[model samples]
Target: MSIRSYLLFSIYRFEYWMQKINKKGAAYMLALQDVTKKYGNQVALDEVNINIKEGEIVGLVGPNGSGKTTLMKILNGLIVNYEGEVVRNESIGALIESPKYFEHKSGLYNLKYFNDLFGTKQDVGKLLEQLNMDHYKKKSVKKYSMGMKQRLGIALALTAQPEYLILDEPTNGMDPSGVREVLRYLRRIAERNNIGMLISSHILSDIESLCDKVYLIHNGKIKKEHRPLVGFAVEDKDIGKIEHILLDMQDASITDNGIVKVPKSESKKVSQLFDEHGIEIKQIEEKSVSLEEMYFDMVEEDYK
Candidate 1:
């Protein structure tokens, strides 16, 4: 083989090895343990713990100002003055906040810029195509809309082909269709490349549809690890009574539509409570829990 070809081959082998092992030669993973961050007197993240292994899609779900960005920034090595441990065993690529580029440069130009900088030898044109941004490749970023720029940001993040990806609100500014497309593409690439992803988004539906595990954060703290709840619809009049009865259940809440949601394991308790309360029987149908419902329950429980 030519000298250049041999060098390229060796690099690929090294990257693959890195992707598969940590310093201990164990399965690769990115982790945050007892991670805490504070800005002056205000805490940004409080004792956060999370882990992601190759080919796994883990999500950080929280509302605005809930430390999702703070966590992602720390993982991406953008913020350094935090207290805690961040364990990373593979190369990382990140798309955080906004995508910045030379205003006068075309999307293709900006992508190529990063590709060369990382020495990843990515085909810029193909990357654009994968992101559905090929049609806009020749347009200067200065003229690009928010959605287009978002796509370009993701494309740039993939330039290095890093084994771990930290994406913050990757679908921000996209239309509904664009959001679906990006989520699908991200899932495909993550699985195909066995890339571990740590994604932060306030969009619970998006997180629910894409992630294998989810960490719900609120008030700069992780409130709960995700567990599916079964929702039970009841009369509006009984909503208050049902909620009161389930008060002891940290994961139970009466949603806005008069549906009482509780952990699947607590279905018996819920049924017994209604029976003892002399509440009329409506068949309880088991259904998948909405992230929003679970978030509401956890946040309310936290306040109590």
Candidate 2:
């Protein structure tokens, strides 16, 4: 190859590697380490460390008084008295607690007001369209139903098109249809804009479908976390039969598929053993774990 062509190739390779490295570094949108928050004698958060990566939609799940709100407040930069380190890589949009709305102003006005806060000039018309709330834009927020108010709040928070978005107790009072509409847009935000969203909600189904992963917090700490599971059912009645089929396998991750996963090297041995047991493999497939099951696992693991 000519020196000119060689140099061009080298430059292209260098640029590609640099971009990959930059993207990897940009993955983490937020990180909290050894964080502690206190209110006189009451500790709201205790030595917490959590990291939120870019392009990740994470749902915070916890019962009331479990410190879910406190963690979200710290994330929104609303609580500055924390004892540990909190880092956010970019600008954020947040609506925490009950979103403060202009009772007298129309929904469009609220959007415009928040847009001005971030010094953005995006058209309210377009935002309303995206949120599927164009019909209610001109109506007074005070007249809006609880669901409508939450939708407007979501629209307002997203007006800035922030890199980091945090919503605490989102969908507090939305009707089923309203909640579905909101989740649809939130999913679009994650998929299309690649925004990292930290949402705390009591709606388990919404969290299951909307989030890339879930974070369970308890007693001011992150008790557990997991990605969703996809799978068929496995009953305890079948466990005994399956165990007899493969008692040789040590600490295998067992599920309904009859000793589902073993170490890669031992997979063949386990499979052959199960096959010999005359186990009618009805369906041996990868399965997604249900959100309810995941929640149970989170609680169980935390307590154990």
Q: Which candidate's lDDT is highest?
A: 1
75-192 per-residue lDDT for model 1 (tens digits): 7666667777777877888888875677798999998877886788999899899889878999899999888888898888889989999888889889999999999999998878
Alpha-carbon lDDT of model 1: 0.80
The collision pairs in model 1 are: none
Please, what is the TM-score per model? 0.72, 0.71
What does candidate 2's lDDT look like per residue over 102-219, in tens digits?
7788898878876776589778778788877889999998898877777777787788878888988668788788788878888787767878889988888888777767877777
Name the lDDT value of residue 73 in candidate 1. Answer: 75
Predicted structure 1, TM vs. truth: 0.72
lDDT of 2 at 85: 66
